[model samples]
Target: MTKVPNVFFICGNGLGSSLACQMEADDVFEEAGIAVNSGHDSISDAPSLNADVIVSASNFRSQFANTQIDPKTKLVYLDNIVDKNEIKEKVLPVVKKIAES
Candidate 1:
Protein backbone atom coordinates (compact mmCIF):
# COMPACT_ATOMS: atom_id res chain seq x y z
CA MET A 1 0.00 0.00 0.00
CA THR A 2 1.14 3.52 -0.67
CA LYS A 3 1.98 5.51 2.39
CA VAL A 4 -0.02 8.59 3.14
CA PRO A 5 2.01 11.78 3.00
CA ASN A 6 2.62 13.71 6.17
CA VAL A 7 2.60 17.53 5.99
CA PHE A 8 3.42 20.16 8.53
CA PHE A 9 2.24 23.78 8.46
CA ILE A 10 4.62 25.79 10.54
CA CYS A 11 4.52 29.29 11.94
CA GLY A 12 6.39 31.33 14.46
CA ASN A 13 4.01 30.61 17.33
CA GLY A 14 2.00 27.60 16.10
CA LEU A 15 -1.20 29.28 17.29
CA GLY A 16 -2.70 31.57 14.66
CA SER A 17 -1.11 31.49 11.23
CA SER A 18 -0.09 27.87 11.29
CA LEU A 19 -3.55 26.77 12.35
CA ALA A 20 -5.13 28.75 9.55
CA CYS A 21 -2.79 27.28 6.99
CA GLN A 22 -3.50 23.79 8.28
CA MET A 23 -7.19 24.28 7.64
CA GLU A 24 -6.48 25.45 4.11
CA ALA A 25 -4.15 22.54 3.51
CA ASP A 26 -6.81 20.06 4.62
CA ASP A 27 -9.17 21.32 1.95
CA VAL A 28 -6.56 21.05 -0.79
CA PHE A 29 -5.57 17.55 0.27
CA GLU A 30 -9.20 16.43 0.29
CA GLU A 31 -9.87 17.80 -3.16
CA ALA A 32 -6.84 16.06 -4.58
CA GLY A 33 -7.89 12.76 -2.97
CA ILE A 34 -4.53 12.70 -1.30
CA ALA A 35 -4.47 10.93 2.02
CA VAL A 36 -2.46 13.20 4.23
CA ASN A 37 -1.52 13.28 7.86
CA SER A 38 -0.99 16.94 8.66
CA GLY A 39 -0.41 19.19 11.63
CA HIS A 40 0.59 22.67 12.73
CA ASP A 41 3.55 23.54 14.89
CA SER A 42 5.98 26.26 15.76
CA ILE A 43 9.09 26.49 13.61
CA SER A 44 11.17 25.42 16.59
CA ASP A 45 9.32 22.11 16.63
CA ALA A 46 9.72 21.47 12.90
CA PRO A 47 12.89 19.45 13.20
CA SER A 48 11.01 16.78 15.09
CA LEU A 49 7.72 16.61 13.16
CA ASN A 50 8.64 13.67 10.92
CA ALA A 51 6.68 15.07 8.02
CA ASP A 52 7.32 14.51 4.35
CA VAL A 53 6.47 18.11 3.50
CA ILE A 54 6.90 21.26 5.51
CA VAL A 55 4.85 24.37 4.62
CA SER A 56 5.55 27.75 6.09
CA ALA A 57 5.47 31.45 5.37
CA SER A 58 8.15 32.64 2.98
CA ASN A 59 9.85 34.73 5.61
CA PHE A 60 10.78 31.71 7.67
CA ARG A 61 12.90 30.06 5.01
CA SER A 62 16.15 31.14 6.62
CA GLN A 63 15.05 29.85 9.99
CA PHE A 64 14.09 26.46 8.59
CA ALA A 65 17.30 26.27 6.60
CA ASN A 66 19.33 26.59 9.78
CA THR A 67 17.52 23.76 11.51
CA GLN A 68 18.37 20.07 11.38
CA ILE A 69 15.06 19.16 9.70
CA ASP A 70 15.16 15.91 7.83
CA PRO A 71 16.99 16.29 4.54
CA LYS A 72 14.30 14.38 2.69
CA THR A 73 11.47 16.67 3.63
CA LYS A 74 10.15 18.90 0.82
CA LEU A 75 9.88 22.52 1.88
CA VAL A 76 7.02 24.66 0.53
CA TYR A 77 6.63 28.35 1.13
CA LEU A 78 3.60 30.58 0.69
CA ASP A 79 3.48 34.33 0.34
CA ASN A 80 -0.04 34.61 1.67
CA ILE A 81 -1.15 32.43 4.53
CA VAL A 82 -4.86 32.53 3.62
CA ASP A 83 -4.57 31.74 -0.07
CA LYS A 84 -5.85 28.22 -0.38
CA ASN A 85 -5.64 28.25 -4.17
CA GLU A 86 -1.95 29.02 -4.09
CA ILE A 87 -1.43 26.34 -1.51
CA LYS A 88 -3.16 23.84 -3.76
CA GLU A 89 -1.08 24.92 -6.70
CA LYS A 90 2.20 24.52 -4.87
CA VAL A 91 1.43 21.48 -2.73
CA LEU A 92 -0.77 19.26 -4.90
CA PRO A 93 2.06 18.49 -7.27
CA VAL A 94 4.34 17.50 -4.39
CA VAL A 95 1.61 15.32 -2.97
CA LYS A 96 1.13 13.61 -6.32
CA LYS A 97 4.84 12.96 -6.61
CA ILE A 98 4.86 11.44 -3.16
CA ALA A 99 1.91 9.24 -4.04
CA GLU A 100 3.64 8.03 -7.17
CA SER A 101 6.79 7.18 -5.29
Candidate 2:
Protein backbone atom coordinates (compact mmCIF):
# COMPACT_ATOMS: atom_id res chain seq x y z
CA MET A 1 0.00 0.00 0.00
CA THR A 2 1.13 3.52 -0.78
CA LYS A 3 1.73 5.75 2.22
CA VAL A 4 0.32 9.24 2.09
CA PRO A 5 1.27 11.99 4.47
CA ASN A 6 -1.45 13.12 6.85
CA VAL A 7 -1.72 16.90 7.20
CA PHE A 8 -4.04 18.63 9.63
CA PHE A 9 -4.90 22.20 8.73
CA ILE A 10 -5.91 24.29 11.73
CA CYS A 11 -7.74 27.55 11.41
CA GLY A 12 -9.83 29.72 13.70
CA ASN A 13 -13.63 29.78 13.26
CA GLY A 14 -13.26 27.28 10.41
CA LEU A 15 -14.48 27.64 6.81
CA GLY A 16 -14.18 30.88 4.80
CA SER A 17 -10.85 31.58 3.06
CA SER A 18 -8.64 29.34 5.16
CA LEU A 19 -10.42 26.18 4.15
CA ALA A 20 -10.12 27.22 0.51
CA CYS A 21 -6.34 27.37 0.69
CA GLN A 22 -6.17 23.89 2.13
CA MET A 23 -8.16 22.62 -0.81
CA GLU A 24 -5.48 24.07 -3.05
CA ALA A 25 -2.85 22.11 -1.19
CA ASP A 26 -4.53 18.93 -2.38
CA ASP A 27 -3.86 19.78 -6.01
CA VAL A 28 -0.32 20.89 -5.26
CA PHE A 29 0.54 17.57 -3.69
CA GLU A 30 -1.19 15.75 -6.49
CA GLU A 31 0.93 17.45 -9.16
CA ALA A 32 4.08 16.78 -7.16
CA GLY A 33 3.32 13.07 -7.44
CA ILE A 34 2.87 12.78 -3.70
CA ALA A 35 -0.44 11.94 -2.16
CA VAL A 36 -1.27 14.10 0.85
CA ASN A 37 -4.37 13.82 2.94
CA SER A 38 -5.16 17.37 4.07
CA GLY A 39 -8.11 18.31 6.22
CA HIS A 40 -9.31 21.62 7.65
CA ASP A 41 -10.39 21.87 11.26
CA SER A 42 -10.18 24.05 14.35
CA ILE A 43 -7.62 23.91 17.16
CA SER A 44 -10.06 22.06 19.40
CA ASP A 45 -10.17 19.23 16.89
CA ALA A 46 -6.43 19.11 16.29
CA PRO A 47 -5.68 16.56 18.97
CA SER A 48 -8.21 14.06 17.72
CA LEU A 49 -6.94 14.06 14.15
CA ASN A 50 -3.60 12.51 15.12
CA ALA A 51 -1.93 13.95 12.11
CA ASP A 52 1.67 13.48 11.00
CA VAL A 53 2.03 17.27 10.79
CA ILE A 54 0.10 20.35 11.81
CA VAL A 55 -0.27 23.33 9.49
CA SER A 56 -1.49 26.36 11.39
CA ALA A 57 -3.33 29.13 9.58
CA SER A 58 -4.86 30.58 12.69
CA ASN A 59 -2.38 33.47 12.68
CA PHE A 60 1.24 33.31 13.80
CA ARG A 61 0.75 34.41 17.41
CA SER A 62 -2.04 32.03 18.28
CA GLN A 63 -0.14 29.01 16.93
CA PHE A 64 2.20 29.03 19.88
CA ALA A 65 0.02 30.66 22.51
CA ASN A 66 -0.78 28.71 25.65
CA THR A 67 -0.43 25.49 23.77
CA GLN A 68 1.79 22.48 24.09
CA ILE A 69 2.76 21.15 20.71
CA ASP A 70 4.03 17.67 20.15
CA PRO A 71 7.77 17.70 19.49
CA LYS A 72 7.47 15.06 16.80
CA THR A 73 4.88 17.01 14.87
CA LYS A 74 6.11 19.23 12.07
CA LEU A 75 4.18 22.47 12.61
CA VAL A 76 3.81 24.95 9.78
CA TYR A 77 2.82 28.57 10.33
CA LEU A 78 1.41 30.08 7.20
CA ASP A 79 1.86 33.76 6.43
CA ASN A 80 -0.55 36.12 4.69
CA ILE A 81 0.24 35.12 1.15
CA VAL A 82 -2.75 35.50 -1.17
CA ASP A 83 -1.40 33.76 -4.22
CA LYS A 84 -1.96 30.04 -3.98
CA ASN A 85 1.13 29.25 -6.02
CA GLU A 86 3.34 31.37 -3.80
CA ILE A 87 1.97 29.71 -0.72
CA LYS A 88 2.56 26.31 -2.24
CA GLU A 89 6.12 27.27 -3.15
CA LYS A 90 6.86 28.27 0.41
CA VAL A 91 5.31 25.13 1.89
CA LEU A 92 6.84 22.73 -0.62
CA PRO A 93 10.30 22.71 0.95
CA VAL A 94 8.92 21.52 4.24
CA VAL A 95 6.68 18.94 2.60
CA LYS A 96 9.56 17.65 0.52
CA LYS A 97 11.65 16.98 3.60
CA ILE A 98 8.86 15.02 5.26
CA ALA A 99 8.19 13.04 2.11
CA GLU A 100 11.84 12.26 1.42
CA SER A 101 12.52 11.25 4.97
Q: Which one wins on TM-score?
A: 1
lDDT of each: 0.89, 0.67
User: Which residue segments of model 1 deviate by more than 4 Å?
Assistant: none
lDDT of 1 at 63: 95
lDDT of 1 by residue, 1-101 (tens): 57788988999988899999999889988988888899999999998888999999999999987989999999999999779888978977897798778
Candidate 1: give its CA RMSD in angstroms. Answer: 1.0
Model 2, which residues run further than 4 Å from truth? 1-3, 58-60
| Model 2 agreement with the true structure over 1-101: per-residue lDDT tens digits | 45566786677654655577677776777878886778877776665676777766637446457556666777776675245675576666667667777
Candidate 1 clash figure, as a count: 0
- TM-scores of all predicted structures: 0.94, 0.77
Worst 10 residues of 1 by lDDT: 91-100
Best by lDDT: 1
